[model samples]
Target: MATTVGVVVFPGTNCEMDAVTAVEGLGGSGRLLWHGDDDLSGVDAVVVPGGFAHGDYLRPGAIARFSPMMGAVARFAADGGPVVGICNGFQVLTEAGLLPGALQKNRGLKFLCQPATLRVETTASALTGRASVGDELSVPINHFEGNYTCDDETLARLRDEDRIVLRYVDNPNGSMDDIAAVCNEGRNVVGLMPHPERACDELLGSADGAILMASLLAAA
Candidate 1:
C-alpha cells in the first residue's frame, strides 16, 4: 500500500502543495492537515514544510507550536511515526519540543535563499535512512532564521547520540557545528533548514532530495 503522508498547513504555509507533489511523485499519497484540526486521519507520515507560521510574529515558530494540529503531530511522533520538518517547520519542531535546538537569525542578519551542499552525517533517522553516512546532497534553503543553536550540553548529547543528520559542507547561516539537520533521539522525527521537497526534481536543480523522500516513504 502507498504511504499516506500528511502535509501540515498553517495559515502562512506556502509549501504544502510542493510537499504533497513530492510525496505523490514518489508513489505516496499526500493529504493536507489543517493547523486547526486535531486529528491526523491515520496518515502514515507527517511533513511540516517551509513557510512563516502565524506570521512569524513572536518568533519563527513560537506561536505555531501551540496550534491544535501540533498536539496530534506530537502524539504521532511519540508513537514512532516518521515526521520531517523543513525550514520554518524545523523551528516549529524545536519550539514544540519534538526536536532540540533553536533556530536563530542568520549571523549577518540576512535572508538566505540558495542551494547548499550538505553531507549526510547519519542514516539512522527516517529522513536519511536511504543515504549512507558522508554522502553529499545538494538542497535548497530559504529562510532568515535558519541558524541552529543549542547549549553545550545539548550539543554534546546530539553528537554523542548521532542525532546530527546533516551538516553544511560550506556553512551559509553560521549554524553551530555547521549543522543543517537533526533528528530526535528516537530517530523518527527530523528537522532541517533545507527544503528537500524543493530539490526533489532534477529539472528544478537537483534530484538528490528524492533519496531523502524515498527513505521517508520506506520508513512510513
Candidate 2:
C-alpha cells in the first residue's frame, strides 16, 4: 500500500509545498492538512512544514500550538504514528509539547539562511532509519530562533537517553550539544530545525535530506 504523509500547512507556512513535493517524489502520497482540521484520518505519517506561523507573533509557534489540528497531531503521535517537524514545524512541536526543548533566538540574534553540515547520531528511530549513526550530510536551515536550549538536567537526560538525533558539525545556531534534531521518548516523533525537504531535490543542490524523508517512507 502507498504511504500517505500529511503535510500540515498554516498561514505563512512557506515550506509546505516543498515538503509535499518531497513526499510525493519519494513514492508517498502527500496530502495537505489545514490547521483547522481535527482529523488526520488516513495519514500513515505527518510532516509539519516550515514557515513563520501566525506571523511568528508572541514567540514563534506559541499561538500555533493551540490550533485545532494540534489535538489530532497529539492523538496521532500517541497512537504511534510517525511525525516529522522541519524548521518552523520543529518550533511548533516544541510549543505543542509534542517534543521537548525550546528553540530560542540565534545567539547572534539574526535570521540565518544557509546550508549546514550535520551528523546523524541515532538510526534507531523511524526518522533516521535510512541514515546510519555517524553519517554526515548537508542540509539547509533558515530561521531566527533555531538555537535549541533546554535546562542542564534536561540536556543531560536527553544525552543519557540517546534522544538527540542530529548534531551540527559546525554548530551554527549555538544549540546546546550542537543538537540539530531530536526524537521523542517513543522515538516515533522527530523535530529538526533544518530544511531537509528543501534538500531532497538534487536540482536545487544536494539529496542528503531525502534520506530522512525516505526513512519515514521505509518505516511506514
Candidate 3:
C-alpha cells in the first residue's frame, strides 16, 4: 500500500491542500488532520505545511503550539516517525520543541515570496535522504519571519552532527550560516523555510521537491 501522509491543518493553514495534492501526486496517500484532533490515524508520515497558524498571533507558531494535535505530533515524532515542517510549519516545530533554533523576522523586515536556490548539505535525514550532498534545488519560499537563528552551542552541535540538511546558495533571509533547513537529532524530523510542495511540479517552475518528498516516503 502507498504511504499515508498526514497533513496537519491549523485554523490559518492555507497550504494543507497543496501538501496533500503534492503527496498524492507523488503516489502517496494524503490525509488532512485537524489541529484540534489528537489522533494521527496511523499515518506513516506527517507534514506541517506553511501559512499563519493561529494567525501568527503572539509570534508565529507560538499559539499554535498549544493545539491538541501538537501533542499527538510530539508523540509521533518521539517514536521516530518522519515529520517535515515547511515555512510557518517550521516555526511550529521549533515552538513545539521538536526542532531547534528559532525563525525571526526578515533582515529588511519585509515579507519574502520568491524562488530560492538551496544546496543539500546532508542526506542523512528523512527529508533529504534521496539527495546527494551538494546537490542544488530550486524551491519557493513565502514568509515574513523565516530568518533562522540559534545559539553558538546549538550551531556547533548541528554542524558536528551533520544535522543541517539544507543551506541557501544566496542568502535571502539573513539566516545564521545561511541555513535553509535542519533536522532533529534522530534525523526523522526536519524543518525548513522553503516550500517544497510548491516546487513539486515542473509547470509550477520547478520539480526539484520531488526528490525530497520521495525520500520522506521511503523513510516512512
Candidate 4:
C-alpha cells in the first residue's frame, strides 16, 4: 500500500502546500489535514510544516498548541507514530509538550533567512536516520524565535539519552548546546527550527531537507 502522510495546516500556516509538495515529490501521498480535524484516519505519518500559526500571536506557537488537531497529534506520537515539525511547527511541538525545550527569539533579535549547516547527531531518530552522526548538511531557517532554551537538567538528560538529533554547527540562533532538532524518548517525534520542506528541491536551493522527509517516509 502507498504511504499516506498527513500535513496539518492551521490558520495562518503558510507552508502546508510546500510540505505537501515535498511529501508527494518523495512518492508519498500528501493529504491536507485541517487543524480542527480529530481523525488521522489513513495517515502513516504526520508533518507540521513551518509558518506563523495564529500569526505568531500570544507567543510563536502558543495559541496553535490548543488547536483541535493537536489532540490527535499528541495521540499519534504517543502511539509511536512518526511526527516531524519544522520551524513554526517545531514551536508548536514544544508548546504541545511533544518535544522538550522552547524556541525563543533569536539572540540577534532579527528574522533570519539563510542556509544553515547542521550536524546529524543521531542515527536512531526517524528524521535523521539517513545521515550518519557528524555528517553535515545545509537547511534553510527563517524565523525570529529560533533560539532553543531549556533548563540544565533537561539539557543534560537529552544529551545523555542521545535524544538530540540535529545540532547547528554554526549555532545561528544562540540555541543552547547548539541544538537544532531533538526527538522524543522513542525517537519517533522530531521538532526543529529549520525549514526542511523548503529545502527539499534543488530548484529551491538544496535537497538536504529531503533527507529527513525520506527518513520519515521510510520509517512509515
Candidate 5:
C-alpha cells in the first residue's frame, strides 16, 4: 500500500504544501492535519514541516507545542509511530519534548538559507534508516534559529547512544558536535535542521533528500 504521511499545519505554517508535494512525488500521499484538531486520521507517518508557527512569538515553537495537534503527535510518537520534523518544525519537536535539545539563533546571529552538506551519522532513526552512515547529502537549510543546543549530559547520552542521525560536513551553525539531526531514545521521532522536502528534486539543486524521505516512507 502507498504510505500516507500526515503533514501538520500550524497557524503560520508555510511549507505544508511543499511537504505535501514532496511526499506525493515520492509516491506517498500527504494529508494536512490542522493544529486545532487532535485526530491523526490514521496516517502512516507524520512530518512537521517548516514555518514560523504562532509567528514564533515568545520563541520558535514555544506556543505551538501546546496545540492540540501536538498532543496527538506526541501520543502517536509514544506508540512508536514515525515522526519527522524539519527546520522550524524541529523546534516544535523540542518544545513538545518529542525530541531532545533546542534550536537557538544561528551562529553569527544571521538567517541562513543555503545548501548544506550533511553526513549520515547513523541509520537507527526513522529519518535515516535507509541511508548509509557517512553518506553525504546536499540539502537546503533555511532558518534563523537552527543552531541545536543541549546540556553536556544530554549531549553525552546522545553520542553514546548513537542517536545523532546526521552531522554537518562543514558545521554551518555551530551546533554542538556538528550535529544536524537527532532522534529520540525510541528512534521513532527525528528532528533535523535541513529541509529535505526542498531537496527531493534535482531541479532544486540536489535529489539527495529522496533517500531520507524514502526512509521515512519505508519506516511507515
Candidate 6:
C-alpha cells in the first residue's frame, strides 16, 4: 500500500501544501489534518510543516503545542509512528516535548532566507535514515528564530546517544554545535530547522531533500 502521510496544519501554517506536495511526489499519499482535529488513525506518518503558527505568539510553537491535534500527534508518536517537523514545526515539537531543545532568535536578530549546506550526522531518525553520515545536502531555510538552544546535559545526552541527526556545514544560524536536526531517544520523531520539503526539486535549487522525505516514506 502507498504510505499515507498526514500533514498537520495550524491557522498560521503556510507550508502544509509544500510538505504535502513533497510527500506525494515521493509516492506517498498526503492528507491535511487540521490543528483543531484530534484524530490520526489512518496516516502512516505525520509531518508538522513550517510557517508562523498562531502568529508565533508568545514564542514560536508555544501556542500550537496546546492545539488538540498535537495531543493526537503525541499519542501517535508514543506508538512509534514516524513524525518529522520542519522549521516552525520544529519549534512546535520542542514545545510539545516531543523533541529536545528550543529554537531561539537567529544571530543578529535577522530573518534568514538562503540555501544551507547540511551534513548528515546520523541516520537513526525518521528523516535521515536513507542518508549516510557525512553526506552534505543543500536545503533552503526561512526563519527568524532558527537558532537552536539546549542545556548542557541535553546536549551531552544527544551526543552520547547519537540522537543529533544533522549539522550545518557552514553554520548559517548560531545553532549550538552547528546542529540542524535532532531526534528523540526512540528515533521515531525528528525536528529540523531547514525546510527539506522546499528542496524537493532541482528547479527549487536542490533536490537533496527528496532523500530525506523518501526516508520518511520508507520508515512509514
> How do all models score by TM-score?
0.99, 0.98, 0.99, 0.98, 0.99, 0.99
Q: Name the TM-score of candidate 3.
A: 0.99
Answer with 4 or 5, whichever has the higher TM-score.
Answer: 5
lDDT, candidate 2, at 164 = 98
Query: Residue 177 deviation, candidate 2, in Å?
Result: 0.5
Q: Which stretches in model 2 have alpha-carbon errors above 4 Å?
A: none
Compared with the true structure, the alpha-carbon lDDT of candidate 6 equals 0.95
Clashes found in each candidate (C-alpha, N, C closer than 3 A): 0, 0, 0, 0, 0, 0
Residue-wise C-alpha lDDT for candidate 4, range 1-220, written one tens digit per residue: 7788899999999999988889899998899989988899989999998989999898988999898899999999999999999999999999999999999889996889999998999989979877778888899999889999999999999999999999999988899999999999999999999888888899988999898888889887
Clashing pairs in 3: none
Local error of candidate 4 at residue 27 (angstroms): 0.6
Give the CA lDDT, 0 to 100, for residue 163 in model 2.
96
Residue-by-residue lDDT tens digits, candidate 3, 1-220: 9999999999999999989988899999999999999998769999999999999999999998999999999999999999999999999999999999999999887899999999999999989989999999999999889999999999999999999999999999999999999999999999999999988999999999989988989899
Q: Total backbone clashes of model 3?
A: 0
Query: Model 6: residues >4 Å from true position, as ranges?
Result: none
List of clashing residue pairs for candidate 1: none
Better of 2 and 6 by TM-score: 6
- The residue ranges of model 1 lying beyond 4 angstroms of the native Cα positions read none
Worst 10 residues of 4 by lDDT: 128-137
The C-alpha RMSD of each candidate to the native structure, in angstroms, is 0.7, 0.8, 0.7, 0.9, 0.7, 0.6
Which ranges in model 4 have alpha carbons more than 4 Å from their true place? none
Q: Write the per-residue lDDT of candidate 6 for residues 97-194, one digit (tens) a residue.
A: 99998998998668999999999999888998899999999999999999999999999999999999999999887999999999999999999999
CA lDDT of each prediction against the hidden true structure: 0.94, 0.91, 0.94, 0.91, 0.94, 0.95
